[model samples]
Target: MPLFSNKFCPKKPTPRKVELSVLNKELGPEKALQDLGLEIGPIRLKLGDQESLFDNGEWLPETGPVSGTHKENHKLRQYVQQLEDENNLLKLKYEILLDMLTQTTAESHLQEKQMEQLQKQVLNSSRIPRTKR
Candidate 1:
């Protein structure tokens, strides 16, 4: 069955057995493999054997700046903090706007009521009958 693969990375047929082709080219000095604790290449066995071969290769050192991993982590942490700060600032601005809107609405309502009361007072005073001289 054909398997789906990324366009950038086409799938390759897994070799059942790996072989040593040239003396100096693909296969170097045999002692180098032994020193690295890698099983002799041109090897054949179950697929699981490949894992050990991969593990045997040299890895990053225990100390020193390793591939700027710490720097990346620091940048991520700072970014999260900055986002949080901006979110909080937005919330504060939203609350202030809401409060301003509430105050303006209340002021307008109070003015409307006062205007109605003044109109009623004026009408009542005019309706009062004046005594004839």
Candidate 2:
């Protein structure tokens, strides 16, 4: 009998360690780590002659600051502010619509009551005796 047989082997397959380089190439370092349920760590990147590190979720160049980083940050802040403003505006509009709906519902109920009263008056008038003119 062979040493490695289906029946002789364990039911579950053994877990194997995957190389970080391979994982980076195939699924990117961040996504691979996330899929493996591992804690996120700084990523290292080699661009031409420079080696940069991505730490704290931000890219840090070994040489010097990259252009447009500040501009990007400003744009992001503006976008967040705009979204908040729009959200507040929507909330205000929703409250106004709710108030309008409540008023309309109350007016509708009042109109219905008025119609019922008019119907009752007409019925009562018809039942009363009238003298010939």
- Candidate No. with top TM-score: 2
Summed backbone clashes in each candidate are 0, 0
Worst 10 residues of 1 by lDDT: 46-55
- Model 2 lDDT tens row, 25-100: 9998789778987885678887776567787788666543443565577689999999999999999999999999
Candidate 1 TM-score to native: 0.45
Please list the Cα RMSD from the true structure of every candidate, rounded to 1 decimal place.
17.2, 14.4
Off by over 4 Å in 1: 1-66
Each model's TM-score?
0.45, 0.47
